[model samples]
Target chain A: MALDQSAQLSDDALLMLYANGDPGAASELTARLAPRLLPFCNRMLQDLAEAEDVVQESMLRLWKMAPDWVPGAAKPSTWLFRVASNLCTDRLRKRRGVGLEEIAEPADDRPGAEAQLIQAERLSALDAALQTLPERQRQAVVLRHIEGMSNPEIGEILEISVEAVESLTARGKRALAAALAGRKEELGL
Target chain B: MTGPNDRIDEFELDALFEEARGESPTPSDDLVARIVQDAAQMQPKPASSEGHEPTGVFRQFLAAIGGWPALGGLATAAITGVYIGVAQPGLVGVTAAELEDLDYVSTEIWPSDDLFFEEG
Candidate 1:
């Protein structure tokens, strides 16, 4: 039997292969990491279109950095998230007047029929509150809370101490709760 | 506060993180595909080699130009001369007599100091 992914080849191993010019490794990394990055970017930019742009740019950066990518130096997912965070922050700073999307826009325009009517408002509120967070806190929360990276892993990706990641995530969660707490009825959850 | 402090252990924070993470919204397949396509196209080029160049007369010339400062200065001077040669006379186009008469009706640029500096 072929070995399972986590046992046969971890992300770092695949990353090493990618650094050595394995196209398959690159595709595998893309397939695995894209899902995690999409939500993280959507949370930060709040506009689905802009979030898509940031994630694309970030992945391009990762590919460019792959040749010199030190194996075991970073988890591919963590690195992608960090790069995506930085990209979104750049847009947030540069794009004047851009803000969180309004929570009430109907989700009918999207192609996927996956937008659940029940959790629609709650999810939108959560997205809006996430958009309002400070860039670093938002990054820390997304990597830690959303991506489930360890504190140390986040610390490495963020170039900070584990304690700092912890502190940032805690403060971020509090801010998110405060921002979304008052909108229960409108959020419907 | 029962925040991520002494009261609330890292495990609790970790658990909440896991729970919250599970609520992640899926991205449209189209979006992921577009981004991945861009990424696949953006594979970084391998570093180029500047070393081990074939030695030749041009290489010897470059070597001597640096070794002899005067030659280096002469090369720069020649380059500057060529630039000036191409550029200086470009301003002195010979307009046809009728064209000049039509154009020069206002400005006294034929053979006067105003041609050099007007509106004194």
Candidate 2:
């Protein structure tokens, strides 16, 4: 398939093409999914390197699973997110003994605009606050609020009911607010 | 005793989430390249005619007879039958002419005298 045509294809369609050994399909899938997946993994793992690893592993699994993938059963992106979510959970479980403060903060490399710096700081604070949340709540909040996914889709990714998803996000937001309560003045919120 | 004034409101938290959304980390080019490479390495090969040609008649016949070993066994059995008929080895040895002269049609399989003696 041509690159343009592959770009226009749906994730399920691309996966089918990939199973049939179309080289273009893999690249198209990577371009479509990697960007979305990386940040979600990064948020979950709180480490860019680990997040990158998770994304690569998840995509590898997707490639292996392409042949057996049922087209209408689930969206490919949802499946990918679920894989990444479970991988992140496993990593987090292994990290139980590690302190959150010990996780290295990502360096800011952007050109310094005063407003941009403020925005970055606020986001950094939000990320730190997010780490304090329970894993399920953090996942729900990130998927619902930051990723702008619907509750039903977040439920699917987290393997929970939609009502449970709603409850998680609510509790997660409350925890985040409490964690960041003192920083309101400093963050200029 | 956390006061209400100390807590960040819902609006403030929402604004922070909005910032976080806008500031999602972009994947490094190296990471993207690595993922694509993995996909390439792991992908299933396409269904193609090259390795999947239709079963030929010879192959079907071979399969039906349970392949080369069975064929060898059958050939051996056939050669032995031919050897026995043509060579006629003299181990216990009735000659071919005597064997041919033996009457087959008038031979009684069960003799009446033997049956009457066994009954008595």
Candidate 3:
């Protein structure tokens, strides 16, 4: 799973491996892409389980596209992010208001119970506020903040101009900060 | 890592982003393992992507080569190159050498006559 660059094949390499029916490519691709993409989906859907499904489906598409998929037109990571984002948006549109649990944190293997509860509360507040925004704003905010992606990267992922990505993100952050105004205390940020 | 092009860069946003990324909400290991195991068991459906051509095929081909993980792709290309290059010239050269070994050139005049003329 792209561990230590041993399996750290390039997108083209992975695609070739994929073409040669190397399943390792799939795993490596997942390892590299999933963490970055998951939060965006989780924020978008406000449902961790659904976001996980979206990640799987996104990887599935990569697998399916391997045979005919070429490399170089777009960044593989970016393409996957875009596809995952679209899938999450679709899922959100299909099932509105799930009142889902906070963005499910990975079961924290460390820390005391009090710390865990506090983190959970922060996540819950953030998730709720994110869920209340308009879809476009949500996408912008998630991609920019949650995913820590740049404007140009977000632009390409969202299929919009860089300027537009910036604009959307600006509006989104303002809206989010407003939605989350009183929630910072719970967030401890 | 705020920069000239950055649109949003408040401490609050940065904190949120950090918290979002820092959380371990990644799918459970069991789930990841299941996905991996399920993947391990999967067999390629068609086995050959050669027949399936998509729109912007060339573009996708280029895209695959655009990243750091393309060693397999590069190897595949190198292998193909060797197959095309060596298989044709090296294979054909050895075959031509073998053909020369089997070639029989007949001479009407004998070397013994020329030896007699030289000695006598």
State the lDDT at A73 in candidate 2: 92
Residue B97 CA displacement from its true place in model 2, Å: 21
lDDT (tens digit, per residue) of candidate 2 on B1-120: 557777899998888888887888898999888988888888877767349867899889889999999989999999988765655444325556776787743433334344334753
Write one digit per residue (lDDT tens) for candidate 1, span A26-141: 66776677777887787776677787777777878887787787877667777887788778878777654554354334333444333243554445545556667788998888
User: Residue A109: error of model 2 in Å?
Assistant: 21
* CAPRI tier of model 3: incorrect
Flag the better candidate by TM-score, 1 or 3: 3
lDDT of 3 by residue, A50-120 (tens): 87888777876776666676677778888888899889777766564553343343332324424225766
Which runs of model 2 end up more than 4 angstroms from their true locations? Answer: A98-101, A104-117, B49-120
Place model 1 in a CAPRI quality band. incorrect
Compose the digit string of candidate 1's lDDT tens values, residues B7-114. Answer: 333454445455556676666778767766765676543333335667789778878767677687898999977755544443345456756666443332333433
DockQ of each: 0.14, 0.53, 0.11
Residue-by-residue lDDT tens digits, candidate 3, B1-120: 323333223677667667867774777665566556645555364455558656486667767778545866788899978755544433334555665886654433324334334653
Q: What is residue A108's positional error in candidate 1, in angstroms?
A: 19
Backbone clash pairs in model 1 (N, Cα, C under 3 Å; residues 3+ apart or in different chains), count = 0
Ranking of all predicted structures according to TM-score, beginning with the best and ending with the worst? 2, 3, 1
Clashing pairs in 2: none
- Model 3 reaches an interface RMSD of 6.6
TM-score of chain A of each: 0.77, 0.91, 0.80
